[model samples]
Target: MGRLEIKSYEKIKEFLSEEHVGRIASIDENGYPQIIPMNFAFVNDSIYMHSYTRGEKLDNILRNPKTGFEVDRELEFLPSYFSHPTDASQADTLYISVVIKGKAVIVEDDDEKTLALNGLMKKYQPEGNYIPIKNNDLVLDEVAVIKIVPESIKGKYKIGQHLRTDSRLVLAKKILKRNSPTSRQTLKVMGFEETPDGLKMVDEPVW
Candidate 1:
């Protein structure tokens, strides 16, 4: 019934690893937030991303090292009608997210740069069709690898975990009938399983 925190480091890492992209925020010269969607790899307790040697985001990071990074998945949207027909205030959404407050630096060391680039490749191209990055690779000169060292990491998720059993059962049935792309997975995370009889709460909530 309280705010559920994802206390499992493994689960947090797994979520970050599987997420396709994350948004990084930096303070611009004018003190406005500049947020960019980036392809990144979570490795060594840090976030690594590659960019052009020159860019607004890179410039912002260089000027102001404090940064924020976030990754989230919107699983399902519960209609207001699920709880109330016309009140329209009972709607809720299910989601999982990780937020980070960190310091960013442009990696200058070739060895660490190589490792970060290779880590990015392993995440984006897991099929193993390309060569591993090397310290002396020519492309390293053209690309800038930004490494974010997190000062704080917070993970949170909501998937009907706070509802009473009767309320949750009703919600699960509605979600199943809605049958959105993520409905089944959402139900599973909420600990529901389909059975010959009907929907059953067979396990504890995963997130």
Candidate 2:
């Protein structure tokens, strides 16, 4: 496993699309760091979130637009017991994560706000039962739409990427035996595939 750096924009976008919530970090008036989880939508190479027109987050953003955001999806836990019963400290969790360093700005344009809000609705409620958002909608004025334009975006996915070919095969078998949905996903992330003979590593492991 090399450094866990996800450099592909498409891969990061795919992971962002699957995730629902992201944590936004800001500096408060006292210069203390404050982090809040928000329902967010990633579109047009930016992150969008909605909040009350007035609040601590809004206040913080007004004072300083610079922000840090992160999103993560956990895969499975690997217990030390699987390798050595006595090495409890060796246990670790596998996961995919994305982090963003950006500047947050309140969207002043009604059209952009409508687009951002609609993107949120599509992400949270893809069934399409809700009414479309309009510029004249009463709720539009009451809610604040924040857009985060990323200065830097990074992603990391850890799933036995450092293991040797034989070791990865053994882990893949174990994951399959576990037969959980996450375990299945773990196999895919490890780039394992089923062949007529046995399991095969289709892609190079990514850390």
Candidate 3:
């Protein structure tokens, strides 16, 4: 199936909100690729993440500001046996992925740091039970906030968007029979809308 791209800002933001972790890639001093997983917050069309005051990531960023970040959510696994009975190679997983090419800047301003930390708290702990971050907090000195301003952002979803109507219907029925949460989510991503009569397929799937 052909890959589907998401170009809508709102849709991209929604997908980013649904994902909590992202992989960030940078170049180390040796000119080697350094990739690490990080908890991130998406706000104001920028990505914010925190780290210790000193780390390999910080060192890499100091040497080079250009970086790549990616976030992805796996929907469901489609086994080849379920479709192409003879070819295991046909097996694949459905997922939504977003990639960002951006410049990373260390946040030194107290107000900006506080705002970024607040954004992180709101994202991971909407329960609002923790103490609010303050500029005077000693921990602020120990932590480093990094903000990524994206030069380009691209999103892709592999959820059977290229499937023909009849094939899509069969897949939807299979997904329903499976009845797992992931299956249900996959159905939604595949543009299967529930109607009074039955599940209706849309011409375009939601990426």
Candidate 4:
């Protein structure tokens, strides 16, 4: 648990968002850590995770909303790292990761709760037949939605940011040349002009 400084809130928010599955960590009865992977939504600068009213995740949060959560799109695992003669510190296995710590609260507002659920469905089931989230007499009590208010969010982008500026530039291009949203992100981080290549490699690379 290192101290995480906030960089661009938007960058980390992008990783926190986008209809992706994320994990939630809480404390269990023995005071040990409990983590669960779940689908989530983000709105109003708050992170959202929901489940049935009962479960380890729900129980822990009810007792304590403070928790840790994370979402990341690994840029590259590299499988291994090597060094050339000139660069003794040559590195490998680059990745883009974002970690967050915050207090999670269950959303109580009827409209907000409904909107949060809608956001989830649109992202996860955009093409499937629509399933509406509502509080009819039959379904209101059984469904529950939880919201996470992040006190601190820190993104550790190891995409060779620690490498020499020259090396970082080269790696950014390698990602950009392939081009995709991920590559486009790499380009933007490197302050490079983006092109059509970024869109092409969108599926191939993770930023």
How do the predictions measure up, each by TM-score? 0.94, 0.90, 0.90, 0.70
Question: What tens digits encode model 4's per-residue C-alpha lDDT throughout 67-105?
Answer: 998776655433222345456455455445666789987
Relative to the unseen true structure, what is the C-alpha lDDT of residue 1 in candidate 1, on a scale of 0 to 100?
24
lDDT tens string, model 3, 1-207? 235787677888998887889999999998998999999999889999999899999989988999999999989887786678799998878788999999999999988899899999999999899998998887779899999999999988877766777887887787777777678668777788767888788646555
> Which model, 1 or 3, shows the larger TM-score?
1
Q: Report the error of model 4 at residue 60, Å.
A: 1.0
Counting only residues 3 or more apart in sequence or on different chains, how many pairs clash (N, Cα, C under 3 Å) in candidate 3?
0
Q: Which portions of model 4 miss their true places by more than 4 Å? A: 1-6, 79-91, 126-140, 169-207
User: Which residue pairs of candidate 4 clash?
Assistant: 179-197, 179-198, 179-201, 180-198, 180-202
lDDT of each: 0.92, 0.87, 0.86, 0.66
Steric clash pairs (candidate 2): none
Q: Give the candidate number with the greatest TM-score.
A: 1
Model 1 TM-score (2 dp) = 0.94
Off by over 4 Å in 3: 1-3, 179-181, 193-204
Relative to the true structure, candidate 1 has a C-alpha RMSD (angstroms) of 1.5
* Candidate 2 whole-model C-alpha lDDT, 0 to 1: 0.87
Candidate 2: tens digits of C-alpha lDDT, residues 120-201: 9999999999998998888889899999999999898777766777887887887777676687778778898878987778
Give the top-scoring candidate (lDDT).
1
Give per-candidate clash totals: 0, 0, 0, 5
